[model samples]
Target: MKFLIVFVALFALALAAPSDKDTVIVEQNSEVLPDGYTANLKLSDGTDIESSGKLEKAGTDEEALEVQGKYTYADPEGKVHTINYRAGVDGFQPQGEDIPVAPVA
Candidate 1:
């Protein structure tokens, strides 16, 4: 019984562990500063992400960090999807082909 339990637990852990064969980083670059930073990443699985963040309204009561980024990935159906987004005081805003548009009244 002890051996069986150990085997099952090990099997479960193996299943939960991340598999490196499915994903790989093809390229990555980053630059960080006191007030801003930028990052770009490309994956072997046809996924790419680029983003930047800056301290906007610095030293103000409403000071906030603004983030702008874009990401592209392939779906299960092999369709490539891209999203452009911004996040900050105005909240997160994203634009993409797969994103549904709000019906204008």
Candidate 2:
């Protein structure tokens, strides 16, 4: 009877244990552009949901490459947004309306 009770408790614990599982799928691709290279990535949530981005660059200045690219994706609310940018010795600059003008030094 004691062995039966212990076996029942173990079985109950095993049934209550959570299963470790991940169901996200990711796919990626890349290619050489005329002036630079571009890469793409995709992630799927199994419910027709996904996100992606890309990066590319070209031209060199003082051992630095002028990097520029844009990425767009839809949010959970179905609103689409994009980010265009450039980066180099001057640092990362985003394309937007509110340009930060340097105050007269």
| Index of the highest-lDDT prediction | 1
Q: Give the range where candidate 2 is weakest over 10 consecutive residues by summed lDDT.
A: 45-54
**In candidate 1, which residue pairs get closer than 3 Å at backbone N, Cα or C atoms, i.e. clash?**
none
Residue-by-residue lDDT tens digits, candidate 1, 34-89:
67677777777777777777887777897777878888877667899998988778
Q: What digit string (tens of lDDT, one per residue) describes model 2 on residues 1-105?
A: 223224333533342233343324365555544444444444342222111222223233344444555444444565655555665567777653334556798
TM-score per prediction, in order, is 0.77, 0.41
Among these predictions, the greatest TM-score belongs to 1
lDDT of 2: 0.42
Question: Poorest 10 consecutive residues of model 1 by lDDT?
Answer: 1-10
lDDT of each: 0.70, 0.42
List candidate 2 segments past 4 Å from native. Answer: 1-27, 31-36, 44-61, 96-105
For every model shown, the clashing-pair count is 0, 0
